[model samples]
Target: MYIINFIVSIIAIIIGINIRRNKRNYLIIGYNKLDEKERQLYNEGKPLTTASNIFIISGILLIIGGILAMRSPVPNYLTIVSWGVFILFIFGGTLYINAEYR
Candidate 1:
């Protein structure tokens, strides 16, 4: 369970790095669907940077939470909650970014 968290965290961090480097806009949902004009209306840099930061931060939080959960005496619910919150945060953040950029 904790191992799964670590693995997902690593993948998220890698994706964040790629997004920050502007090498993987296609990985962004709905990014590739925009035509050139719509793309122009959408400011690319700020939203991508923000989303990347969100991903990186969430990934770090997952790692830290996983470690804490492993060391704590609590059951696996802590990890489950952490993962749930992470997913919601990512989803909400992505929606916010898309709406704001659009």
Candidate 2:
């Protein structure tokens, strides 16, 4: 169970690093869908940096939560809460990027 969390965290961290390093707007989801003209309207650096930070931070939190779950007697609750917070972050981040960047 905790292994799954670790795997997901690692993946998220990889994605965050990729986005931060690549600095390619095409790597972003909704931003990618924007046509060239629309895409040009926004500054690239801020949104990519913000998104990358969000992913990296969330990934770290997932890893910490997983470790806590492993040592906790109530692993189930911890896992559930961890996943719930992750989901919230995902949605919130998406909304934030779309609203702020676009």
Candidate 3:
């Protein structure tokens, strides 16, 4: 269990770093693809704002959960955190699909 937690923590850290590094690019691509009014609204904070917020929140939670799992017997928390990340992934995919189609 400890080893499992350690592996999960390392994976989470790597994932977090990669996602954070690319976030600006993601924002740029998403922003540029929007119409002027949509871009303005995104800049002002609306639906698009949630994307980064959710990603960051889920990433942080995953890291924390991974750490906690590594430190204790409660490794199941990492599973929950992983599920949250999965949900965010789905949400992001849906957003991309909607944007691409419309």
Go through the candidates in order and give each one's C-alpha lDDT: 0.86, 0.87, 0.53
Rank candidates, TM-score, best first.
2, 1, 3
lDDT of 2 at 34: 80
Q: Tell me the RMSD of model 3 versus the true structure.
A: 6.1
lDDT of 3 by residue, 1-102 (tens): 445544554564454455455554344345466777765545433333444444555555556656666666666766566666656764775576446534
Tens-digit lDDT track for model 1 on 1-102? 899999999998998998999656676679899899887887778888988998998899899889989988984988988898899889998888877878
Question: Can you give the TM-score per candidate against the true fold?
Answer: 0.90, 0.91, 0.40
The model with the greatest lDDT is: 2
Worst 10 residues of 2 by lDDT: 24-33
Q: Where is the poorest 10-residue window by lDDT in model 1?
A: 22-31
Off by over 4 Å in 1: none
Pick by TM-score: which candidate is best?
A: 2
Candidate closer to the true structure by TM-score (higher is better), 1 or 3 = 1
- Candidate 2, residues 1-102, lDDT tens digits: the string is 899999999999999999999886776667767888997898899889988988888898899889999999999899988988888887798788879877
**Candidate 3: residue 91 Cα off by (Å):** 3.3
